[model samples]
Target: MKTLLVFEYRRGKLTEANLELFSFAAALGAQTAGVLIGAETLLPAYPGKLYLGDIVKCKDYNPEVHADIIMQAAQKEDPDYIVFIHSSYGWDLAPRVAARLKAAQVSEITGVSEGKFETGCCNGKMRRLVRPATTKAVLTIQEGAFCFTGEAEGTPAVEKLEPSADGAGLEFAGYEEPEKREVDLAKAEVIVSAGRGIGKKENVPAIAELAKSLKGELGASRPVVDAGWVDHNRQVGATGQIVSPKLYVACGISGAIQHLTGMRNSEFIVAVNKDKEAPISEVADVMVIADVMPFVAALTEKLKQ
Candidate 1:
């Protein structure tokens, strides 16, 4: 099999999802090529033909333009499989690539073997197998779903590409930098989440200190995020980010269904609330009922030992 990976860069490097997709591609034992579109001072070593470019450096993004850039490379490379990471860019670009090539698209594919692909449904509660009818396939992969294949043997041969995207339907607008993240919550092993039960923003240190003692990342519920107690990036719930940490500590969370859907898959759940009847109790492996502040403070003090 021959594969083409369209990579999106983050901070002058391949995004984590792109790296993971590359790992998946390498494991398929297929001949692989890459088309990277961005300006990056440094690139990780890859073991394939790499068409690196900076065409979008000064233009507003138009999916048609990106699709054309990809297609120009595709015409030269003629890959049997074109792969993308299911990111904001991927959502826009994949369909265009698929339509132009008149190929079947297997989206959010989590696993692939023997020409069969696996995907998740119902917010990852159920799995389904997909087999494309076409000889060639265009795939978009979900983040964190695939195991990374080990690094390739040597650096890839790099070539420059100069495909231009004509601004057809969109124009460049002003850009705003996103909020800086305090932590990478998705990679955290343990997470301590605060909900409305935490009482006030000033009392957050009591819970945060406890999370610190446990060597866990501090997460916030929607209310906590809305109340300006934490950055929106640290918010965890249906409206926020979904997390699946090794240990999930729910501090004063009422366990709304929206929040539950985001974290129900966590390996171990420990719920703490003054009200034992809270919905969170249903999913908790261990439940603690008490005034949240005193307990958090005492636990924080104990963990100092």
Candidate 2:
């Protein structure tokens, strides 16, 4: 099967997620290739074939124009599967490309078998596998679901495709930086995430103390953030900042699929919850079933000794 992996050049080079997509495509079958749409193009390190197109005039994210460019490349390659990383750009462009090609599209894919996909269902309380109704498919893979192993051998051929984009009456405006975050949790090595089960906002400092004792950043579930127990920037879950820390300590989190989807990629997970059946336990490396605040308090006290 031929797979087309579309990549976005971020900052100075292709993103790690882009390479992860290539790795995923490699396993999907043979004839793996990559496509990039930007102001300029470069040969990717992927061993499978590479396609690059220099998007002229437009410099920012215009889904209409970028999707058209990818569609042009796809027509030449005629790939059986077109894959994109689940990012702001990919989430927007993948559907457009799928519509243009009249192909099936799946988003937030965690696992893919011969003809089926695995994704979270019922707010992540269950796993649902789906099989595509068509052979031609477009998919957006969840970031960090598939670990990237650099196994591409031998230099692959690079093909420069014709870049075509009208931008659909969209104009590039000056970019404005997002407000500087108080704590950039994405880079933290260890994160202690608090959930609503911590009882009340007054108990938050105990969790904070545990985080301090562990020398980690303090994060929160959406509920905790909504309850004002922590800043919104410190929230860790879907619709919040995604973190891939070396250690993730989830305190009282029920492991809602939205939350699990965000931090399940952490190197090691330790969940402390009274409910043994919590969904987070499925992905945790260590499960400590107990009252949330007392455990944090005890851990903090013991660490002080």
Candidate 3:
């Protein structure tokens, strides 16, 4: 069955989630097609036939405009499935598209089997949760859910289809660049994440030391973000950056569903929480039940030595 894949290119590069989605769509017996809503110049190489259309331009992301463009593509392709990566942009646009098309909607998908989607949530601040149902549906695959493969036997043919210049009354105002930081969590090979168990803002130094020793990025749960212990970009959860690093060491995180939904796909998950029964422990490849500060200090010293 043909599947329409919605991908956005930013700053002249395809988003990582789109690459993962393309890899997944290939495995699901779907002939992939591409869609984008920006300057066509931004998209370098699309794997499959391109749905050539000029989306309504806005200074920043406009869900109304984005949803309209996707729905417009859906009418033309009428493919068996539509997919997105459950990122901030996807969450904004997916539900609207699903509602307009009267199609099933699935987000934060971890796996797919027999056309049924499996999903879970993970955030350190809240309790665990699971999505109980799945359907032959429109899905926003979780960022780390699928391992992306850039290799293809032959470069997929690229064709651009015309889209009429009509959408909700929205026009491009201008552009602004987001602030840059020293650490890019998305590319971090190792991450040291702090949770409520990390105690106070003062305790974060221990974790930071550990991260420095390990040459890793420092991450935080939503509470730490809300507490202003770190920059919002440093938070890792449903609302934060979804990271799939080679090694993720979560300290004092209880493994809320929203949080887990983000990082459960890591290659190796190592968590240190006092509660062994904490939901995070269930998915952890290595679990250590201990106090956050002492563990961090000890681990930092051991690594340094």
Candidate 4:
């Protein structure tokens, strides 16, 4: 089946979610085409057909303008399937594309096997499976739910495409850059996450010190994020970024339903809490019963020495 994979670029290069879409598209045994709007020079080399719509300009992103461009491309490719990532951008554009094409949108897909798409249920009950109703389908893949593979069997043929005259009329008015943060989650090898048990706003720096000692990223639960102790992007939960670092240390987090949805997939989970009966202990590879602040501080100082 022929497939068109749409990805949003920042300053010309493909974003993380785009690379993820390629991985999923490759798995479906569909011929791949990448639809992008930017200078072709910014994109890293890829094995696929490439199309550029210079008119779809945005310093960052504008939903309506983006949707219009994608719809135009969908008409041009008329592929059996169109794929998007369930990211900030995908959330805005996927439904619009589906509406214009009159296609079934199978979105929030967490797992994809040979013939079925798997999605998460609220309480880890059973994963909902959706089979394609027709040969033509539109899907938005859930980011962080799947790992990426660099090896695809064959190199795709690349081609240049020009947008239609209607596409040329749209304009990118303005954009504001997203708030910058100190860490990049995708590249973090080790992560240290804290829960409400840290007790007070001032104590977060202790966990930060541990992360610093280990040269890792600091992540938090929803409460910590809501408390304004850290950036929202640092949250490790269903509503936040999903990370799969080499070693994940959970401090004071009780492993609540919402929190586990994010970091449950970590390679190694270590929980530190005074109560051995804490829910997080069940999933932790190592359980430490202690006050989070003291333990984190001692650990950080020890590591430094």
Q: What is the lDDT of residue 192 in candidate 3?
A: 93
Cα lDDT tens digits for candidate 3, 1-305: 77788886554456766777776686677787766766665563654566544443433455666676676777767777788887767777788888877778877777776666677644333332333243335778777668776753334344444443334566545556656656679899999999889889988888888888889989988888898987887888776788899999999989876688678878999999998888898679999988878888888989989
lDDT of 3 at 16: 64
TM-score, model 4 to reference: 0.66
TM-score of 2: 0.81
lDDT of 2 by residue, 1-305 (tens): 88888987754556767767866776676577778865343545656666666655335566676787788778888988899888777888899999988888888788878777777666556777877787688988877777787654566576766647677677756556556678989999999999988989998888888898989999999988988889988989866888999999999899876688689889999999998878898899999999988888888899899
TM-score, per-candidate, Cα-based: 0.67, 0.81, 0.72, 0.66
Ranking by TM-score: 2, 3, 1, 4
What residue pairs clash in candidate 4, if any at all?
none
> What's the lDDT for residue 40 in model 4?
49
Q: Relative to the true structure, how large is the alpha-carbon lDDT of every model?
A: 0.78, 0.80, 0.74, 0.74
Worst lDDT window (10 residues) for model 4? 162-171
**Better lDDT candidate (2, 4):** 2
Clashes of each: 0, 0, 12, 0
How does residue 260 of candidate 2 score in lDDT? 82
How does residue 197 of candidate 4 score in lDDT?
91
| Model 1 lDDT on a 0 to 1 scale | 0.78
lDDT of 4: 0.74
